[model samples]
Target: MAKSPYPVINPGGGPMGKVIIALVLIAIVTLVIKYPSDAARWVHGLGSVIDGLVDFFRTLFG
Candidate 1:
């Protein structure tokens, strides 16, 4: 018997995975298009929070 050249690590979740991914991509695009400013502010706030945490850690250690 011959073995498959490309083995199937995950045999199932083929079409379903594609569909879920497509839906998620569509949602993200729609959000970016509809709420451009809101999205930008949200991302900026996230960056600020991360920077504050880094500063706090540096002050604590050094």
Candidate 2:
């Protein structure tokens, strides 16, 4: 079998799986290029949500 670029993504997986992932990555990159501001807002929103969750868990346990 061919060596994968990132083994963690598809451990013991095949070339077909890699091709599908590459296509999905390409699509995402295209989307980000088309809508950079929207993507930035989305990523920032996700970071804030994750931060809120961490703070909540810390207050609950700490």
Candidate 3:
């Protein structure tokens, strides 16, 4: 029996799925790297995105 190289649970998943995630992460990272504003803006944007989820959950629970 020839064992299939095709993964049942793909480590990369599909091409599009990986690409979309990579792009979003890249966008945020690029914002950090090349923003015209101060470091505060970059830090705030990154912090907000990460904290946004937590704030949402707090509001939902509260």
Candidate 4:
């Protein structure tokens, strides 16, 4: 068998990764709780953008 040349490194490999993820989750939850309407609007706008892109591609190919 032959060995590959590259070495693998994991970014989120330890307790620090868990801490970072938890902090991010906390921040997102805080934002949603503090500004529910704004978060909803942002999500709606993202969906609209995705829908528009899909429609554009469908029209272009069809």
Where does candidate 3 stray beyond 4 Å? Answer: 1-12, 36-62
- Residue 61 in candidate 1, Cα distance off native in Å: 1.4
Give each model a TM-score.
0.56, 0.69, 0.39, 0.66
Candidate with better lDDT, 1 vs 2: 2
> Roughly what TM-score does model 4 have, to 2 decimal places?
0.66
- Candidate 3 at 45: error in angstroms? 7.4
**Per-residue C-alpha lDDT of model 3 across residues 1-62, encoded as one tens digit per residue:** 99888847556678977888899999877876787476577678989898999999999999
Per-residue lDDT of 1-62 in model 1, one digit per residue for the tens?
Answer: 99889876554467877777789999988989999998899899999999999999999998
Give Cα-based local distance difference scores for all models: 0.88, 0.89, 0.81, 0.91
Q: Candidate 1: worst 10 consecutive residues by lDDT? A: 8-17
Candidate 4: segments with Cα more than 4 A from true spot: 1-12
Instruction: After the best TM-score superposition of candidate 3, give how far the Cα of residue 12 lies from its true spot, in angstroms.
Output: 7.1
C-alpha root-mean-square deviation, each candidate: 6.8, 6.8, 7.1, 3.1
Error of 4 at 14 (Å): 1.2
Best by TM-score: 2
User: Which ranges of candidate 1 are over 4 A from the true structure?
Assistant: 1-23
For residue 8, what is the lDDT in candidate 1? 65
When summed lDDT is taken over every stretch of 10 residues in candidate 4, the lowest stretch is 3-12
Per-residue CA lDDT of model 2 for 1-62, tens digit only, reads 98878747555378988888899999889889999999899999999999999999999999
Candidate that beats the other on lDDT, 3 or 4, i.e. the better one? 4
